[model samples]
Target: MTKFRFYFPDNKDFVDPNFDGRSNNRTKYHRQYDDDHYPHQILAELPYDGMLVSLAGVGTMQKRGKYYDQELTEDFYFSGARKFLRLDSSEYERIRLMGDCGAFDYHNEYEPPFTVDELIEFYDRGGFDYGISLDHIVFPYFKDEEAKDVAAEKCDLHELIAESERRIDITLKNAKEFYVKSQNYQFEAYGVAHGYDKNSFIRSVKELQEIGYRRITIGGMIKSKTDELLELLECLNRIRESDTQFHLLGICRFENIPAYINAGVTSADSTSPLMQGLKAGKYYSVNPNSIRFSESLMIRVRQYDHDNVQKHIDKYRDELRQYISELQDNNGFDIDLSSAALSVNECVKRLEIDCLKKLQQYDETGLDLDVTLKALIAYERVTNENYLPSKSTESKQTQLKRNEDKYHQFLLAREWRQCTCGICKGGLMNIIFRSNQSNRRRGIHNLAIVTKHKNNVLKSINPAAK
Candidate 1:
């Protein structure tokens, strides 16, 4: 069996649960927040075959204030990703590190931002197992941000085709040089295939094959529809050598994993279940035993109204304090302090922690779902970034009624309760909270699920492996 692999793209998504509802606050930061806290640390613990780190992503860490605050850009260049991730540790012996140009980050540049030699230096220094050549993306097919998915098909076909070929030409030129220049490097060299459509995709893959790349990754599919992706993969399979391996870049779907593996993909990377965490008011519920989200099982928050959430917290201050007091068991929980004595920010942080505490207790003993939901809903209210504005036309009562219906479905399913992933450590309910902690945990858990599905498919195809 050609063992299929799945690599997660590192988004530097580690979260500090104690984060004071502020973005990038230094006092709240921890290098190993996921490691130390429950619902497990994603990077060290995620059961993935490999991880893909983009040079473009690292380039941004050049600024002193970001998460990788301990290292400067030159520091990273010297130490490389392997040292950064500490993949050298005995615990991560099986996990491979892959490198990419992270073209999308520098898409606006007329040419790829980094040199071939620079990428080689990076991947080699990091002890990467695989690295891709820098390739400029075909821009026209990429949907413009404001237009959503409508922009891709709406682009002039002639322009799309012309621009795709132009970019493919540049990609091939880089690939030939990258492969030749990488002769002394230990990592396997893979080139990117950029196609605006089916034939062009095949042509690019064929060109990559001719360049002596045994492994090729198909890029520019983030905007493609499911059927379109399958179609492209099917065509590539027809022309390629039987042993040639392919990867799907930036694919963010669980459903796509097994289907694409069947269509000849060996590995892929994406920002799913993790990104699901950052999205407001949305939650993923596994489809019974399956990895993909079950719409019927998913939960919806009533609102991500940051302004209203703050207003409600202020309006119900006395009631919230009373509720906390009653739950304190006479010892007086730290949250029992008068609101007047605490800063508003401190109060919100306490309530958030209290909710996580309560949720953990509920997860252990199956506490009343209604009460747990109230606490979670409270935290969700305060922590929400208001990603989605309330529809001006909808009445508050209507949103509440719909959310109630969604909550009813969520309780009936409660599949998240069955998950044994580390993210549930904060409490099974913690995985469902709309806060940064829950969302990122859900995403990491989602990636693990995808890898599990990939292995399952691989085993099904080769039954003896079981």
Candidate 2:
């Protein structure tokens, strides 16, 4: 069986996690939670085969040379808990090597591809079961962001694969070659996506099958348009019909882990604790059996709203309550509500509108294309920079006005249309009045073009306690 693995960069002392790559404000920036940890020792502690030891990409200034950080030395590996027990020299001889798909120079925008031979030498000398890492295999070209140029310059398999395949093939070939030569070894490759679509991912998986590659890992905190992570997993299930082991990246929340795995992901990874330590000057201190929120009061704040926005909040809360109710009623705890609730297409619609409202509130000019695009291209890359048909070097001020106008026009066109929020069906659109019911802001929920009659019926049936 292909074992599920975790990367552990050693933080033996749990020393101060600060580094110079960030501002000094102590803000938990994304990188703080996303990168940097010595993982060798930690990975050894996991009971599952899914864990792989990787050098934490923090504190290392130079990108080249045989040694990455202090973590790569054989001494460190030998001293690791697994070194004496699970990882013997003979076991190492019979081991397979696996690498994260995104760990190479080309993926990081450095010059000169790290050839497969160099990688094999490193893994062989390092004495690992598998050499695995991520590579930019499939580049999705949305509007203007063409993968052809990037592929031509960085990917050697450009002619052999599509935008998505280019990224997967590099890792696949590298792993396969290692397995063939070692005779005593086996290898697997993973594909990582910070931002790519369900369709593109499906296509990439198909191409992987065509080339006989079987393992895939998906995700990053990159803006994903799909509202539910479960939806993404379901898409993976569709791809895995032909037998592929799916891995979820950076999954720290315990409640969410089973959902992904149940949806067919063979294993998962979590850097949240390390990320938290780097971010807030402390670790997240995760409990694998519990669910947590980023802030304790977010759900409370949503629950207490005095305006129509509370309707949306209430819907989410009710959904949560319903899941719990189902768990109790069925006496079974393995329900996948994410896949059971809605389709990916429905999720994209709700996310696009919600993100658009957020962009309007956050964007200074009320038309920040980058921010909007970031949200817009959450799951998929809108690579076509020139795809903006209207604005050709338009001023920011003009762009804001144009975008606002477009937004209002969309409202007018979709008027009387009942738009159900993707997160919850109970939140259909209603006519929002400019009443200062609470400290509420005018949001997409406020302007939702939903089935007001159905909302009225729900309001009548489930009125808030006065």
Candidate 3:
């Protein structure tokens, strides 16, 4: 039986809530951060044993020179015993450039791309358990002739192919060079296999094997659909050797994991759960049987509508006044009527009213209005600020017909409340009610749930392992 591992990609923006330069310095943020923060030290604290961080990400961070610009020297990125696979910077840059040229939208900028030697130095200094040879691969979107033609005017296909071949040669040469340079390093270097078609993929794998790579990573499949990926997996399966282990780069779909594993994939990586959690409507929960469930939160009345803003404010104000009067009548607390008309249309008013209601519900005394207001303001600023709900013009019947399945799933998950994950432990309402940290926490919880499911499956298959 084969041992399968899931690798989490290090995307600082998604995981770290306090990633800004003020709270935490950008230079050492990746390598070090406060462990007490829920999502900041996720990589270190999470059960995941493997990580897949890009050289381009580190290079970009290095180029910015946030904290350790002058101190980077030549090997700052890889100075610790972190178990990660160092991906080549070229493919990352190509994706950035392609996005710049209108291939697709990519978030990060491509800056100060690292050379092969720099990568090697980074690897040597950073005590990684495993490293992958750098290979430049083409994006799957370029397979379409029309798309290729459009991209060719700006990014030439011929040039990309040549560059890819050159990178492969460099990767192979560097793998051997590094092996000879640091024979006692104890780090395993795997070759990267990249190609567009079946024959090309076979040739790439065969060449990597010939160059003394017992382990290979299959690239150029990130954008591929499930069917397309399966076809590629089938092609690889046909030529796979018994002793060689293949890692599927960026293949993180839970439903497709079993298929990939059955097709001979030993390991894979993805940030889907984390990404999903950041998006609107999507929420993740774990089922009783350990299967992960995804359901969209029901869209409620839009709070941002120009017409309803005043209406909501008026209603909340009425509710607040009524509650306060009830409290006064029952001699529950002292009434401060001076702050009653404190700009009802303002967000601060809503936050204060909400917090006060919560306090009243809990029957708490010594209400520090200032502290509660400040805390609520901070949370609202991150979670609810600038949030605009989309106004759909479709009929209610039509909308229900379209979202029948989604509604069914939402109802099922809402009723059961069996999901015991950290995020869902607070109850489905915490995640269903959209808030910045809650959404991200839900994603992290989903990742944990899916990881457990994967481990369980692997354990069942390989029951002999302790």
Candidate 4:
């Protein structure tokens, strides 16, 4: 049995909630901020082994005055990957560092801007245990039958084939040089493979083996459908050499894990599980993991995403709360300030705060589900936040009712308390609260689940390793 490796791509995702969900200068890039806890540091303190970090930071883009800057925000010019991530200490021995060229960053280009020597220099500076050679992207089969978007309009068969073959030639040529020159470098090297079709893909892999490259990564398959990818893997498995290893780039389908392993994947990495938790309405829930596991389901919680309108709501709620406190000083805590002299906006702001208090209270005691959610529905209608519900001319009453139904299902189950991970140990409310800090914590929790299942599956395959 081949010992499969599971690598997680680090994105510096988790943040300090106190800094409005932003990392400060102290703990922004480094890992040694022990005093404040930085929410106790999940990727470092947790059992997040087999970590993969990119040289240019994958999907790195920032907007300037008129145009966007493709440069990664981290000043890696002075510090290496480990130092920048604050993983230089011996405590993070579990994290097996892998450096990636982030070829997807320049996928649209005719050729990679950075050379093989430049990547090798980056790998040496990163102090990585494993590194992938640079390769240009080869798009999956795209013709008149497939594309739904404007890519269909610009589909030129002659230009597409010509461009794809150009990428393949350069990638293979560069891989040969990279693997041969990699003898001087410290990190173990893997040549990247790119091709448009299955026959072309197999031919590229064969050339890689002839170049004395034992490890080969199949690139440009991110857009390929599951069945198409499996067919390619099946073909590759027939010609797979015992000594050589294979890895799939940017594709991890947790729904069909056994199929991929059976098709022969020694290692793979993906950010989907953790990122799903980060996105609104994309909540991932899993069955209890034993030696044998079941399928995981992503429950789409239908509710208004208040992140964008939260600042405005917060401002109104704060002002109203202060005024109410002053009113309470004159009358009493039990006094009916509901009938006090106030505008419609002030009344709505007060309602929003009241609804929020009930929601928080429900999180603690798990009581008042109906009344609290009803109050929330009323407040949601009053505020009319920037979500689709507000934009559409649909029945507000019907939308609010659907929101209540979803919240009822979500809250009644209490999925947050299911984990024994370090993040879940804090409090249930913190994990499920409608805030970025909560969303990130929830995502990291899902990653823990994913990590466990991957290890267990591999353990089942190779029992003697442990």
Name the top lDDT candidate: 1
Report lDDT (CA) for all predictions.
0.65, 0.37, 0.50, 0.64
Query: Quick one: ranking by TM-score, best first?
Result: 4, 1, 3, 2
Which residue pairs collide, candidate 1? 34-41, 39-422, 39-423, 40-422, 273-443, 274-443, 277-439
RMSD after Cα superposition, model 4: 6.9
**Model 3 lDDT, residue 333, Cα:** 40
- TM-score of candidate 3 versus the correct structure, residues matched by position: 0.62
Candidate 2: 10-residue stretch with minimal lDDT: 294-303
Ranking by lDDT: 1, 4, 3, 2
Better candidate by lDDT, 2 or 4: 4
Highest TM-score model number: 4
Better of 1 and 2 by lDDT: 1
For residues 99-164, what per-residue lDDT tens digits would candidate 1 score against the true structure?
Answer: 898898877777876778777877877678899998998744332234334554676655656766
Worst 10 residues of 1 by lDDT: 384-393
| Candidate 3 per-residue lDDT over residues 1-466, each given as its tens digit | 6567777665543434333311222334354322223332332224343555555544433453222333342334544424222223332221100000110112132322444455555455665556665455545334346755776788767876665555445445654654445355555776677665566677778877776677787876788787877877787887778778888776667656667777778777777766776665556544436333444643221223334445654655554444444443554343343365554344334443554344233223324544433333332322231321222234643553444445344543453155545344444334432344445656676566666667666665678866
Backbone clashes, each candidate: 7, 52, 1, 1
lDDT tens readout by residue for model 2, 118-210: 544444444555444434433333221353455457755445344345445454555446445545444444434322445565665565556
How displaced is residue 55 in candidate 2, in Å? 7.4
Q: After superposition, how far is residue 70 of candidate 2 from its true place, in Å?
A: 8.1
